[model samples]
Target: MTYFNKDIETLPIDKLRKLQNERLQHQVQMIYNTVPFYKQQFDERGLKPSDIRTVHDLHKLPFTKKDALRENYPFGLFTVPVSDTVRLHCSSGTTGKPIVVGYTKKDIDIFSEVIARSLTAAGCQKGMKMQNAYGYGLFTGGLGLHYGAEKLEMTVIPISGGGTEKQIMLLQDFQSEAICCTPSYALTIAEMIEKKGIDLKSLNLKYAVLGAEPWTESVRAEVEAKLGVTATNIYGLSEIIGPGVSQEDFEEKGTGSYVWEDHFYPEIVDKDTGEPVPEGQTGVLVFTTLTKEAMPMMRYWTNDIASLYYDKSAKRTHVKMGPILGRSDEMLIIRGVNLFHTQVEAVLEHSTDFSSNYQLVVKREGTMDSVEVNIEINPELYKGLLKETSLEDVLQHEKIQQAHKMLTKKIKDEIGLSMKVNLASPGIIPRSEGGKLSRILDLRSK
Candidate 1:
């Protein structure tokens, strides 16, 4: 297989560990001397940079949470001056002040390198045309993919996001070989193609690198089957340097994405205790940017729940991380039962009557938490149902009632949670328009 950087990608485990240790020590010393937040963390813990000479000592360092970034505001945590940094990116900050991160020229180059490696892993080749559908301007996804595609010597369309008509138009006209986008948006494109009766053969798209939101294997199967492309996951956060920290190889399929441990040291820790978890067990994923220069984060708690393990038969020596199950904060506890939207998705995936476009609505009713799943019936199933009854009376149809009863029972049996299910028309549910689509609506907070 063609690799962007085969030497580092296939490095020996011992050598990779040693490289991570050296980078970790340098990063610790740099943060200790430069950023006051890290410096204070060291002093408050009664530790010094010298104490962290290897990756094993990383546990001694305090976990850097998002609250710490917000407290720092604009550039308080940055090691270099803003003028010296090449670019700045920030969160949407809908809830509060946006957490901003800066990148130096070197940092930007490293970002491109990792993304190039990711695209290569996702079955992209040099000279292939890549249509980047990620949003640009401050969101990291757009330019991150653009520069990396360019670095891989692939022609990038830089389409940015939205404009479904234009996205489909260019896919046919340009005959792009690869596409980068969120999984939901890719589904939207696939749906539009079906509605417009666009022949899949007219497009040259072969690979899809999807991320920025947690997705399930069902979503991958849907996108791949509809778009006629191999869908792979590319994972990263702006805090850790965009969407290239790790990537799933197209050939490996469902195994796991390989984390580039040389640049970013990863660890899985207990969500509540903050202690490291046993290998191959699910926990919160954490990372320390070993080579980041502008905003090197040490043990940044991603809050994303996933497990890390090594695949002995894999091509890369780096540790492989399972698909992000769900964010610990985003997980819902309904009436004493913990529920992740993906768990519900897994249940629905087994049934052909419902579409993947579904939402979980959580509400509090007199101190009792209730969850209602809003799911859209598959268009084909809806048509078959409509033949038996009118649209207004479809909910009363015998088949509809039977399917609903089966779904409720399956969810209760599989997830151990009883949830109300609302089956709607094919187009009633909202679809993503080239952006991260939230699947859960927690009205309890509102």
Candidate 2:
């Protein structure tokens, strides 16, 4: 019911479009005048600043990919002088040169403003305490949420992810009401709470805001039930703005996340043809920053596959985006069946006999690619089985065998592909200490 910025958030459609067009045109002029990359891009297509009069004219622009940022390197894409920008954060450069993002004081403030809107939507309130478990430093999760919480008037823990012991201690001591972290890490914490035999009632956790990786309803239900909180999804990419480009309302969990359109204008385009798709059709999500002062991107392709539509019965006026199924680059084709690991993870969530800890192992058998799913048996289930039989029964146990068969069938039924399933002991699969866990092991490279 509450919004961080109500006036802009609920702005009428016509006025909102007018604002977006004005900002888009200004952004075009600013980038064309300053950044050489955009200058040449415009020149190549003979795109004058006057040509882009509205968001509808966005199709005239070429898409900016992650590689473009890499090709530009550190400061090449920046539209302002070094002295004008206040700070810089960068990707790990794992692929090659790091994609560095600079922020002016105004840019940082806008980042906080949008995140404030996000936290509020995720059931955060003024004076409520939040344990921010996202990483700090160059990574935008920690500090982005931190400043945004401050802006929203909430107390932030600034734990910076990991250290299960300390995180548990402060949750009790601070009586925090909300937590922000990756969904996988939230599951790890839930498992730790079970292993530690902590009293869930003693803690005062009310909400879990999760993102940075694609997750499913199964994960959401598990985290919410285990952590005793309502879990909502928050989406973002570092290129456009760090976390808070959109947020799922706590009340509207499964529906979709509302894109704060006053700042970020969104459009879905066919991945192959690079043409705009009809509304409600799944395609690559693209963004054009409307009011970014330091670095405004035009038609920056996010590569995330999801449909967008206006929810007429929703609380806000902004268009909403469905949960990201998977990134374009992460889609794996095994035996010509296109699938994402999350699709498999969704099936696992339907069964209680399995924990969220699982891995996808991909290998090439001769000329065909094969995927093997290795999921850990729930510790609770394992403990129950131990009381009834010996370790040898794991192979022959009817219930254990049934659960494994059900999981394999679910993958085949839901994901449209048959993957080899290996049910391992509780601790067999690795867990996330703090950061994002690599779920897919592509051994085909070797």
lDDT of 2 by residue, 33-106 (tens): 99999999999998899999999999999999988898888888889887899878886447778888888898
Candidate 2 residue pairs in backbone clash: none
Cα lDDT tens digits, model 1, 247-290, are 99999989999999989999999999999999999999999999
256 in model 2: Cα distance from truth in Å? Answer: 0.3
Runs of candidate 1 exceeding 4 Å displacement: none
Q: What is the TM-score of each candidate against the true structure?
A: 0.98, 0.98
Tally clashing residue pairs in candidate 1.
Answer: 0
Worst 10 contiguous positions by lDDT, candidate 2: 90-99
Clashing pairs in 1: none
Model 2, CA-based lDDT: 0.89
In candidate 2, which residue ranges exceed 4 Å CA deviation? Answer: none
Model 2: how far residue 305 lies from native, Å: 1.4
